[model samples]
Target: MTVIDAVRGDLAEVRAEVDATLDRFLAGKAGTAPDPCLPPLVEVLRGFVAGGKRLRPLFCHCGFLAAGGSPDDRAVVWTGAALEMFHTFALVHDDIMDRSAMRRGRPTVHRLLAEHFAGSREDDGVAAERFGMNLAILVGDMCFAWTDELLDRVEVDPPRWREVRALLHTMRTELIAGQYLDLGGDPRSTADPVRSAWRMTRLKTARYTVDLPLRIGAALAGGDAALMRACGAYGRPVGEAFQLRDDLLGVFGDPGVTGKPDLDDLRAGKPTVLMALARQQATPEQREVISALHGDPDLDEERAERLRDVVVATGAAERVERLITIRAERALSALRSSSMAPAAKASLSDLVAHATRRAR
Candidate 1:
């Protein structure tokens, strides 16, 4: 098989292994739940986690192998599964904050919970919505706790474990801080929207999604500072490219393929680099249109299309495409220069392509 094919096969196997680990872990939690009602929450988490690409776990596994750790090590798998659990927690909270109705082509956790509780309330819609948000918040907190529980079970020497714990803590803090920025904190209020967007992307996605996972895995395998630094060099740029591609897909991708409404980002006024660029480069007339149409709760398809046209006409989309290429190249360069295992290098190279160029 080609290197890319081999990497794909290995990633599929890792995904299955991580899924099995998560299934077994959650089953145990469900079986031992303090309250019978908690089992359903575990069930919801299980369902929500089942449909992801499992990219974080795959990257962690690659990092482990890159640092000379055994591919068959169960500790590596457990750590990777912990990362996935943390990701689920983040997504659940994100959906609530965004007021997103759909995730993974179904009602979001909050929406699903709201609908489930609808029958018990006199003011069914309003009360159910409140119930859903509250319960979903608790569910997200549970997932966060479970992630730490899973990580705690992984066997490593004391120093390595300490390093791993530090990385994990840093990752969580960076993600939460990034989310705050995304939710219109001080960073979002900056005059230079593009710079603010990039800063948020680095904190929210680059470190959390790629850099920390790789470094954490490497640390677990006792990799030194230099190797961990190399991982950051490679991972951060690729991670940024991944998020940039996601921003593009949010605005321009087919809903059937993306499993998300294309209009959601526009309506939510997400401060993406693409939008920032469009705003910066727009003509006065286009800016007026953006001001009137963007973030409108009742924004229709026609106006969204016009907004899209403005983005495209301003060349922001093409500029983002160029940026993706630049970052992917930077990642590839780092991979080539590093002394990681050849197989790991090949897998990471494939990952850069997959992460940056995917349609969904």
Candidate 2:
């Protein structure tokens, strides 16, 4: 079989294994829970986790193989599951912060909880919202705790385990720092929107989503510093490209296809690279239109369309596409020079394409 084909086949299998592992783990937790409320939380988390692309776990799997770890080692799979759990925690908190109503095409955790309590005696609308946010926060915290528990179960040797744990610690710290930056305010309002957006992307998405996952997996396999560096070299550019593509999708993608409203980003005043670029390039009249309409809570389809047109007219969307191309090429170049297994390299190449080219 071609290397790419072999990697594809392995990835499909790994994905299945990861899914099963997650199911079994969550089921076990639910079965042993002491409190009745814990069962419901576990169930909600299971549902939330079921709908993702499993990108982090897949990357970890690829990294494990790249570093000469046995594909048959189930410890790697459990580690990937731990990463996914952490991701769930991040998403739950992110949704709360954004006041997002939908995720993976369903009511968000907070929204689900809000609706559950809508008709209760204490269900003033605002109170219901507050209650939902509070509950979701606790749920997110539980998921974070679960991540450490899952990692603790993975049976690596002491030396490799220490390395992996350190990577995990760094990943968690960087993610929190990035999230804090993201919560600071809208990028458009910042003095240097591009710089702010880029920093936030690197922290919030790139490192957590790509760099550290690969590093952690490599560490678990006792990969040397050179291999870890190669992973970082390939991961950062591709990860940034992934986020840039997401930025484009947030403004231009079909909600039905993306499984979330396109208007959410604009409504939230998200400080994406696309928006930052548009802000930089817009004419005076265009700037006024953007400032007035971009973050309006009641932003309607008509105004959104106008904002999109302005973004397009400024050529920011095209610029981002070009950026994706550039970054993808850089990742490929790094992969070619790395001393990874041929299969791993082929798989990473495929991932680079997938990450940068997806409709959603």
Candidate 3:
């Protein structure tokens, strides 16, 4: 089997076991638990974690293997679990912050919780939204709490935990900062969409999605500075490619498969690399249409399809695709030269390919 095939096998086992552990953790909690009611938190976490691709955990495990740590080791499993919990927490908070409606073909935590609240005797919209957001925020906090608790179970030295902690904190901060930057929509940078898109992609998605997971995994496996640096070099480009692929999907992917509204990115005025390129290359009249329709919530299918035509006719999608291909190639080159184990390199290569080529 290929490295990914093997990793998926191991990943299946880890996911089930980790889920059971989370369930147990929730069940064992006292009614008088120090924090808010544990049941809601547990339910939200379990729901959020369901049906995920488990990409972050795979990265963590791959890093361990790359650093010469055995998959059979208990520490590797715990490391992966900790990182997965961290991801769960991040997603809960992210959905709340973004006011997103769905994830992985299901209602997001906030929406789910809000619907549940609305069903109660008090069915006010404002109240439901507030309750849902508050509950989700706390649920996210609870997940974060569990992540740290899982990490503490690792028998690694305090110094090692410190290093991992710093990396985690840095990743979280960067993701939040990226979200803010994206929301602010600074006009000066919008003048040059390619550079702006690259910047946003790197900060908003790449760093947290790819780099931190590998770096933390390597650190936990006692990888040295040079090896860690190599992993970072490998991850960032692959992460960018991953987001670029996501951009492609956002514009062109089937809603049934992608589980998102079509052209939602355009509606959000996301300033993606593809959109920027289209803007840069469009005729004056085409530019006017794009500018007027970019973020219009009332944009209909006819308009959206026309905009898609413009994006393709202008060659922006092709250019972004080229960029994705180039970055994927560079990422592979870096992975090959890194001081990681052969199996680890193979796994990373598979991950890079999967990230770049995913249809949804």
Give the range of the ten consecutive residues with the poorest summed lDDT in model 3: 1-10
Clash list (residue pairs), candidate 2: none
Best-performing candidate as measured by lDDT = 1
Report the candidate with higher TM-score, 1 versus 3: 1
Model 3, range 1-360, lDDT digits (tens) per residue?
122333435555655666666556556543446766566656666666765666777787778778877777767667667777778887888777667787777888888888876787466898899898998898888778878788777777777778888988887788777776666456768567678777888887788778888888888788889988988899899889988888888899887887767766777777777788899999998898889888787788899998888889888899989999999999999988888998788778878887888766
Candidate 2 segments whose C-alpha is farther than 4 A from its true place: 1-7, 119-122, 185-189
Off by over 4 Å in 1: 1-7
Tell me each candidate's RMSD, in Å, in order: 2.2, 2.8, 2.8
lDDT of each residue in 262-296, candidate 2, tens digit only: 89999988878899899899999989988998888
The candidates, ranked best first by TM-score, are: 1, 2, 3
Of 1 and 3, which scores higher on lDDT?
Answer: 1
Per-candidate TM equals 0.97, 0.95, 0.90
What overall lDDT goes with each candidate model?
0.88, 0.88, 0.78
Clashing pairs in 3: none
User: Cα deviation in Å at residue 144, candidate 1?
Assistant: 0.6
- Cα error of candidate 2 at position 168, Å: 1.0
Error (Å) of candidate 2 at residue 21 is: 1.0
